[model samples]
Target: MKLAPLHAAKAAIESMSGDQVLHTVDGHAFIPMDDVWVVATPSGPASFNFNNLPGASPELRQQIKDVCRALLVSAAPSRASQALTAYRVLIRFLAEEMPGRAVEMISLRDVLRYGASLKAKELYKLRRLKEHLLLWVDLGIGGLDDDLLIRLPDLETKHHEVGAAVRTLDPETGPLTDMEYENLLSAIRNAFTEGKLTTSNYTLLMLAITLGARPLQLAMLKCGDFTVSARQDNSKIFILQVTRIKQGKGIRPRTIFRPRELAPALGTLIQQQCDEAREWAVAHDVAPEVAPIFLSDRSSINMGDIGLRGHHSGKSMAEKLRRLLKDLAVTSHRTGRKLHLFQSRIRRTLGTRAAAEGHSASVIADLLDHSWIDSSLIYVETRPAMMERIDKALALQLAPVAQAFAGTLVMRQDTDRGRIIHTATRSQLESVGTCGKHDYCRLAAPLACYTCTFFNPWLDAPHESLLDSLLQEREILANTADLRIAAVNDLTILAVADLVRKCGEMVGRATK
Candidate 1:
């Protein structure tokens, strides 16, 4: 940016004496001098408290705010809070060590000392500090001087080995083993079906897990975006137009959106959610316009009580996901710990799954709606080796921990529960279990039942044969295609292993 325009903006900022609302290029407004600046952003209202930077002078606050205005005007709302965070760290650094000193008093030595003081893990923080210092110099705001400018270009030339994406490398972080994702997805469905998760939340979780859409994009979803497109494969295709963010300046943000296809069931659920959002808007006396799908209902899902746009912030989505995960407390067989759930983890898992399915970086980028392929390069680089070694002992060991089999054991010699849960063996209807809670199950019989809690397996039935068949199928698929595709039924394999162990123990005890 030219210093002339920045100076003119600074001049305009300096002229504001009383409470003044500054409008961002993105159509959001905030008072620059407020104790807590509640900036209305597409994601939601982000609050940055100047009081958090204690013992800071009004002059320092004004300078920070003035410099940030250029950022707010040009960049996305998400960057605004981050810029504040970077500023706070610098000001706090000055206040602690350099007492009674203005920000301008810091020399190149002070800059070097501050840079050295930061831990390696806070490399991003150090970068942010260096960035703001440069901006301050260029914009003529007070922070650092020209002496450090010579070393600034050298910092860019420093050699460093790049690390793989943490989410892809760590099993605990996710690219969740197919089994783990299946279990969590099942758990979430159960939670929603059992009256735990509301329509808004249930739909949001589905979209996140299924599409890997960012929370910012999801938050920006309006009721109108959930529209039906042309028919494909004899089925009506539901298209969700997700608003794009961080697309860089000069590109119209929300005006340019990516259309993502939703599964029929999820599409139906989202349509239902849109209905609720409409009702909610009417109940709240909010004139029906383009409104957010996930309305702010942290208090209650009660009609007329839902908060309007920017209420259900991206933070709100993250918090909701956190609470849901905490409530479910789903344990991971891989780590024997509750899965560390995050939206980013889910997004990473989506990318990893695509990569494992032999997708290129460009394909992964399109899947992730990334403007550049560089962001998705990490997933394709790291091999998803979560399912390479799944022997019987390993399966048995993790089986109990996974709790993948939610079915009840049917030991009796009767089909009295509801219906016979049977699969084919040697061209015969071989009964394995009973669907105890059978109310016309839409799931694939026998295979899906093993993981369901409703299935009651006959104790002495051909469960071992079932296990053998699934393992054989898994091996066949792995040899021919991706291990990710082969590992789709891994949870069921664990279930069958757990069942096999139980059946053997029960049969032996009876013989004894």
Candidate 2:
């Protein structure tokens, strides 16, 4: 049969409806098996068309569609898409060896020849083909021969796993170096403080940095998922119930989730974003209870399609995030270039940092939400990049946190009364240093003063107390929140640590 032309096919396309599948895109629908389906995937709605397989006979396409449509009911949403890829390869093989033959006509010899036709790089993809063939045969007699299904070669994929392990050690593609990680956190804080990063985007980056979660998991976040509890002192402990992805066959995000306690700083940022997202979602007629927190702002979106929208682009959150980081233009110390900020890199960094802190594989696996221990092995095996103290691993740079001892060291605790400046921190207003510049300034108060050349710090100020507080916060956040959050104050900690030493020497010398 001569297939329909593209222009004719465009106009002749038919639509179908299923509880899950929205429609079809078949130009030549020989059987009613739905050759092409536009289905709602976990991330968003997607189209999977089998019309590319024109070489596939009507019987073979029917068998393949039967297997895939059945899978749509029980398998993960990605399975249908993968089946398209695997079957397309089979269709390509058929065009060469057996033109337009039905499913049951293919034998063991034919299947072996198909396998041999694949290139080395394409071998892993064939694994899915063999599985698809078996599933096809199980559907009916109009499939590959039973002998081929029984005697199919099992792929030895240990080499693939080992290759993945080696890639995890790469600085550019895998785990970041200790200094590079530090710079990343510093840049995040700096960008946020400067208002270059928005509140929602800040929360997005914080989640990615801390949890190392995939983009789909992040996209699945809902407003109500963020819950709050209290500690003994009534400090609010925020818990984010993150959705799980890539769990296994047939598992959906809503079926499984893991709760993680967020750091106070991040909790504050996400709380602001939650209020904004929830307000927007509710005003748009979506049920408040089920409103998504990670929403997009595209004008073309219908009120009904807002559910599970990825980001501003109506595309994957991965692309949205990559664009956000690229827009922020976070520069790396290693290459002096804009950091790409890949999610996989964040995950590897998170894993390696956990391993460097003496956490076992079980702990690393739990932190990364890995389904198997083998996936977490690379972190344990390759931790040489992270040798810094746990608290300093991914330190966020302070706004003024960037420098140490830039201010004048005065001999006496007494200062020119008018020169002294007061700032509030931890709910208390205290005088830290005197400002040398009297003109109006918009920089963050005490932090900016520490590195200002015109500022003068007194010997009797509570520098030790501030240093202690910084260290304590960093230590707590590292364990409860994440290494990145704990280390956010690292530069400021170093700055304070330097000041304390300088003050001590100045005081001791004056007394002598």
Residues 1-512, model 1: lDDT tens digits: 23454566566766776477776656666677677766655455667777786546667776676677765655565665777787687667867786776554445676566677777765556666665566556567664446765565345422233334543367666567677788888778767756788776787788888888877677667787779766656677888898776675435446788888888899998888788778877876665446567776552221122223423566666777667666867778778888888788888888887887789999999988888898888878874765675777787778888877777676666557577878888678898878777676789988988877668898878988888888888888888976777888898899888888888778898899
Residue pairs with backbone atoms closer than 3 Å in model 1 (clashes): 406-453
Candidate 1: list runs displaced more than 4 Å.
1-8, 24-30, 33-36, 42-45, 51-58, 69-78, 100-106, 142-168, 193-196, 232-234, 249-255, 287-289, 298-311, 413-417, 479-482, 505-512
**Per-residue lDDT tens digits of candidate 2, residues 1-512?**
11122223222323333322322221111233555566655555555676776577677666566555545544454666676677776667767665555444456776567767777776665566766665555444355666765676453321223426334465356677655575566566656656778777787888888988887777767777888789899999999998776786545666688999889988887788778777776687655546666676652233234345423322467787777766755445445566667787788888887887779889988898999888887777775532235232222232123333456777445556446666566878777777766654676667656645566777777876777777777677766875655655555565566677777778788899
In order, how many clashes per candidate?
1, 4
Could you give me the TM-score of model 1 versus the true structure?
0.86
On TM-score, the leading prediction is 1
Work out the TM-score per prediction.
Answer: 0.86, 0.69
Instruction: Give the Cα error of residue 350 in candidate 2, in Å.
Output: 0.5
Predicted structure 1: lDDT: 0.72
